[model samples]
Target: MQDTTDFEVWIEDNEPDGYEEIYTLYRSVAEREDNGIWAVTTNGDKTFVTGPTSTLQLLSEKARRTFLNAVEALKSDPEMDMESWYGYERNMANSKA
Candidate 1:
């Protein structure tokens, strides 16, 4: 696995908006079946299974970056809402089909 600290720095620099980019990256990572199960957790401690990963290490790095970015964005934007973030993620998933 890549150093999560490095991934954190990358995410901090990227500062992705909403959940679209992260969600899409996660879905792509999850589609690979050889890796272990991928999961995500929210600040509220809610957890969800993302999928089976073909590249567990890589996906772990991606997840760490994504989650870090999400947390940062949420903190930066006080008005940011989780419902909207989830809705955006769903829409991105739908569009991928």
Candidate 2:
């Protein structure tokens, strides 16, 4: 596993009114599977996972530690486990077909 302690966070500006600000937490390293990028946002009460995506750069030192902690949590999440290894290969294959 990549070092989750070395990740970064980038917050988005110009967020639409009534919507919480969005942030991008990412890591730059050798790609093993998906690019080390995750989207984060809050619903005025607390932070929540907006999902994952690919990112190139814009690493922020201000949010480094916090984002890295979040990355560690995300990495351990069972929901992010590989479908094939979890016995979803047949269903996935059928869906692809």
Candidate 3:
């Protein structure tokens, strides 16, 4: 079985698709007991499952770039007051709602 570290790298690189594929590769290491939790790290870090595993495979490189940019923005502005990142996302969600 591949480790979590390797799987993380794989996802960042290949971005495999299909629930069965993801489950096969990541289920043992990443599956969470909680209903809302999709994957949890050994260190207890958590990331929500944004969509179906197949959706992840279909994500465009441009979308990945945008996501990385957002992560960079959040990291560069760790002080919440410096950048209301969560607020921006909340507003975006509200607007969509």
- Give me the candidate number with maximum TM-score: 1
Name the best candidate (by lDDT).
1
Tens digit of per-residue lDDT, candidate 3, span 18-71 = 333333333322332222213332322433233223112213434434443433
Query: Rank order by lDDT, top first?
Result: 1, 3, 2
Q: Which of candidates 1 and 3 is the stronger one according to TM-score? A: 1
Report each candidate's C-alpha RMSD, comma-separated, in the order given. Answer: 9.6, 13.1, 11.9
lDDT of the candidates, in the order given: 0.42, 0.30, 0.35
List the pairs of residues colliding in candidate 3.
Answer: none
Residue-level lDDT of model 2, residues 1-97, one tens digit each, is 1212223331222111111111122232111122224343333323333323223231343344455344434332336433222244334446664
Model 3, position 28: C-alpha lDDT score: 25
Candidate 1, number of clashes:
2
Better of 2 and 3 by lDDT: 3
Candidate 2: regions farther than 4 A off:
1-60, 77-97
Measured on C-alpha atoms, candidate 1 has an lDDT of 0.42
